[model samples]
Target: MTKGRSTTWQERIDIVQYCLAHQHDYHKTADHFQVSYQQVYQWVKKFEDGGQDALKDGRGRKKAPEELTEADRQKLEMKKMEY
Candidate 1:
């Protein structure tokens, strides 16, 4: 969290997307986002490991996807059939 300016959750996500789309121009991106070159690199890394979700407000750690229990899934399918 650098000083001077702060970005919203959506803004951070957009910055990551922009960095991924323009990886070849790292300096340009740094200037556009008003951040350092290393920050741009970090954003690209986050996008690569995960998708847009990685850019959101959090501890910057990825939690494994939750899996539905076998019984729960069966119940859901049964309910869907009734509709």
Candidate 2:
């Protein structure tokens, strides 16, 4: 949740929950969460700043092609059948 980098929604939630539950020993909680202490710290910060919504998935740029249009896909199928 730092520097505008995207993180998985589950990661955010797990990190926050781990820290909250083990606040007495954050180092152990960070290890249990499989993230650096810094990440746990960040998630806790985000939770404090914006509540549960802060733990939602971060949006990122995707590299895949868009879904084909219905018409275009039907035309392609028709062409295949004609062959």
Candidate 3:
């Protein structure tokens, strides 16, 4: 496995597509992309489960109200009331 490196969203999508195209060969994909095998595997899995949108880097981003579950919305409301 190669050392993982930062990849852009488009790169991740490309990697996932490549892996899928090659019959989910994670090792080959990782080697070709110069990323860790685990990264290729995980990206492919996420894409399979949720499509391209799932490949986004979502860290530190707040969810929109509509994107939250009912329970989560209620929790947010309670926290707002506390403040």
Over 1-83, each residue of candidate 1 has an lDDT whose tens digit, in order, gives 33336677778777777766775477777788887777677767886888777767677665433566777778778999998
Candidate 3, 1-83: lDDT as tens digits: 48768999999999998998999888888889899998888898899899999999999999998899999999999999999
- Report lDDT (Cα) of residue 5, candidate 1: 60
Candidate number achieving the greatest TM-score relative to the actual structure: 3
**Overall lDDT per candidate, in order of appearance:** 0.72, 0.69, 0.91
lDDT of 2 by residue, 1-83 (tens): 12333458876776677677776366786667566667667678888899988876646944333566777778778999999
* Worst-scoring 10-residue span by lDDT in model 1: 59-68
* lDDT accuracy of residue 41 in candidate 3: 86
Candidate 1: residue pairs that collide: none
Q: Scored by Cα lDDT, where does model 1 land?
A: 0.72
TM-score of each: 0.55, 0.52, 0.75
Error of 2 at 69 (Å): 29
Off by over 4 Å in 1: 1-4, 59-83
For candidate 2, the TM-score is 0.52
Angstrom error of the Cα, residue 33, model 2: value is 1.7
User: Following a full C-alpha superposition, what root-mean-square deviation does model 1 have from the true structure?
Assistant: 8.5
Worst 10 residues of 2 by lDDT: 1-10
